[model samples]
Target: MTDETDVLEELASLPTLAHPTASPDGERIALYYDITGRNQLHVLDVESGSLTRWSDGEVPRAVKESPHWSADGERVYFHKDDDGDEQHDLHSITADGETEAVVTLDGQTTLFDVGDDGDTLAIGSTAAGQQNLYVHRRSTGETERITDHERAAHSGVLPPACDRVAYASNERDDSGNQDTYFVGVDGTDQRRLDVGEPGAETVPVDWGPDGRRLLLSDTSTGLNRCGVYDTTHDEVRWLGDGDSQERPVAFTPDGDRVLAVRTRAAADASVVYDLETGERRELGVPEGVSPFVRFGNPVLDDRRVLVLHTTPTRRLELLCYDLETDEYETLIEAEYGDLDPDRFRDAEFFTVESDGVAETPARAIDLSPATELDIECLLYDSGERPSPLIVNPHGGPPVQEKRSFDLYTQFLLTRGYSVLQMNYRGSAGRGRAFREELYGDWGGAEQADVARTAEHVIETRDWIDEDRIGVYGGSYGGYSAYWQLVQYPDLYDAGIAFVGVSDLADMYENTMPHFKTGLMERYLGTPDENPERYDARSPVTHAENLDAPLLIVHGVNDRRVPVSQARIMRDRLTELGYQPGEDGDFEYHELGAEGHGSSDIDQKKRTFRLLGEFLDRRLGRPVAASGRGDKQ
Candidate 1:
């Protein structure tokens, strides 16, 4: 008999690594480490090898995240939830380990910046159901609202100076598009920085050392690009100055140049741009990995740029880019080397005939070695016939699927299942035309693209069992899974959805107030503008068409998608005669304390175990004993 205790023990033994944050002075680094099942912040002195724990004697309900050092480096500020409600509050810990609450608002508080003098804190709060900027004075305990705009404000630090703040707000035009704005410490002299026009939104990613030059990431009309705006001259210069999408990672400490990550389909490379000469140099790294390699954000010192890079064989390792030599050096390697590049299979990219003009490009990574593929297949039989196949459609139906390293993908591969991840049309990384393919045709084009990708995989790969193929995803991906089971009842044999939206109308109405207005109108047409489109695409309207076995997982406190979505679907499935724990028809599980994403390790382990069991049962694979309690 399989022991449940053994499963729990195995789960407790998994290794976890948190992103490391460097102090302002760059002399100390603070990071959250999961030591034997608990996540805690640990500070290490660069010169002395001294380590200290900053978490004050409490088992936090959520993991400590976004740790930033105060201007003076005397204190460290972090976000955590102690009350189990999942609302994060900002807290500060002194160098000597004395901790105190900086601000405790009703909703989640994101600390944007601390003044250079360490007296004023710039924070973004969602207390009013939309994000608004605020400044909290430590000396007087006075909290003043900075931006009172009708739309949401995302706060960031201005370049060269820590006293001034830069944020993006949709105040000027209520069309619900954001524009970059700069404000002083006293919240006066707020002016719109002309990074882009009214409809073209600008996102401030990093500031130059002198505060006179700013690096901005712009995503207008579905294409991503990066540029540098000179605050003094009010001149904007595009990095790379071409058609490809780009992102600025950080500015050099001298403010003379900016480091950026440039990405295209199937290829990602990093480069540095010089402000004075308008010259760009490539920081050569391996291909096939994301360009956002840095742990916290890319940090610059006099000699080297500290970044985190991960190859197919590597998890995430810290590397140093030396400016003088234009070379790279490995600093820290990820512990999981056993499951490196050679162990897993690689995918191939091809052009698919779509919409009469080859409008979309397609890529497929084979989970196993095979030539002949199965079409309209729930499962395909290689030498390992009957082994389960999990088809994961990525979130952001507008986002393209890529050959990248994902933790969940690795975990499933270890469990002896072939996984197929598809990047359909409307996904980013592709050019503007391909990404906007689903703009007015979200459900129609995106859904058809996914179905086509599945058919292509089954027809080309002999390893996948056409009958045992299961669909799984979260958020938009989850919505796709639900839609697939309902719209094409005979396509997938089983389905798993996490925080999926059953009704587009309910999702738009109940989502966090800030994202509700703009995002809803963009993806799904407004309730009044395109009523037919909304009614036709929404999964809730086609619930009766569901024919496959389904398992729905949701966090009860999920404010983004809300638990009610899963609840409504569960109730409908039950009403349709699909019952839980009865030969895999329908089941729903809600984590009492989780929100949009699962943070607790045990809950994550549970989610994986349940998913594995469901797929195993439906696909006729031998279910391995649960790896829950097998800790060392």
Candidate 2:
């Protein structure tokens, strides 16, 4: 039997490295490492395998974003936010640890691309009510706004010349459809590329090694397709069949091939596409292992690339891959102190069929039972028979559950709890139609698919305890927890929602402007435009129907979903005679210094403990009282 405390501590204490970028000469790498349990900028000498901390605790900010190397590779550019406020400010630090702020704009400012000349930076800021493009010159300390739009616009790669930029914008009449556009640095000659289908999203990926052709990633046809737009020819040459979701990682050093990852059912296969002969070569990665691509650059030396390798039973490890040899060496090994990797459970991927039929108070998505929708799920079953199950819906309608290590899931398994992660109808990684299916039917078909699939698992698998099932999630998943409890109250014994949306209409009003136009409006339109749908879908609207125990956790400084979501749920439950505190079933926790989620290690430990304690109390399976006194 596993010691619950030992499992939770080691898993929670697991160190993490993220946002890695290779230096220009490929001798060093810059990334954020949580070695001290607080994420900070660190530089790793590739040859010596020595790590050096660059950023001091001068400002005491969270460095959660990616770091980029300047053209000359003298300094690394990164973004930091106050606590978890999510208002990112750009900063640069030299190898010698000389740090300085590059640009501090209002609202959330993202450093998109550092130009080839190393002086100009392409950025997107929400300061203007919505996300817009900006060009900042590092030498002069001057900033120029390139585009003023009501919707969100994000920049792609900045070419060597830094004269023109490519970006994706949803400013079209149909806000759901996004297209790639090119504009000069002076904000002139702004023209749409006419690259994708009518409603598909075409986003710029990278410039070819020569900077003459732009690599474009298209999701307009459900599966991802690639296109090379030649500036001189003024034409796009499309690549790949519309089979699987293929994403362009980078161009080969010689510009003869494109490194792309084809994703099918959440599994990725890295392949190189020959531009001249249309030949495809697989990278021959081990089965069930996926390469983690950094936001911008993943390439290291001329033929080497950096990838974060992860498997279901393994934690994420940074690795350097040689394309020519198809071999990789672990740069930073994932450490799980005092824990055995063999104790970790592997995920069992399966699918459940649910008809696209749904019934809602305001709307019905489909009535035909003939149209069955497939919902994919990943289950990590505990060895114990009749295991208490936690149905965990992933956070995004756009983010699906991947075959990767999850400490929380592992912790739960050690406590004899089976975890079920679902990709209900409208989740990403399955293609565009699978994603868009949840649009306009937020709590409708998507919710149905999740509940039905959970039910299917409970019925088919005798190992899952139907009576002790719980629903848990963060963000959209958090919203699903509330919706599931209220909609199918008898199905769940308890539910936990983290930074989740409670009232759809209120979320639309209170969230960031970019979320309103780019995310919410794209799904349910404006609350004013579809008030009935919004009212019907919002969980707070159905708070009276909540019958099971609920634990609501939200970051007070959350800008994406807003803390008001948790407040609204708590207020409604209070009004419905559900008192909160240690004495009540409806519990609420407001993280003071956090935004969407927490970056503090102690806070994470506290959260896990709280969650475990709640599950123990609600499920009537309290931890065995060891010498540690009732196993806190």
Per residue, candidate 1 scores C-alpha lDDT tens digits across 158-182 of 4445567788877653343568888
lDDT of prediction 2: 0.80
**Backbone collisions counted per model:** 39, 1
Local distance difference test, each candidate = 0.66, 0.80
RMSD of 2: 2.9
Residue-by-residue lDDT tens digits, candidate 2, 507-552 = 9988988888988998999988999999988888878878778999
Q: Mark the regions of model 2 whose C-alpha exceeds 4 Å error after superposition.
A: 1-3, 58-63, 357-371, 622-632
* Candidate 1 runs further than 4 Å off: 1-13, 44-53, 56-65, 82-86, 159-163, 171-176, 220-223, 290-297, 337-353, 356-387, 397-402, 431-433, 622-632
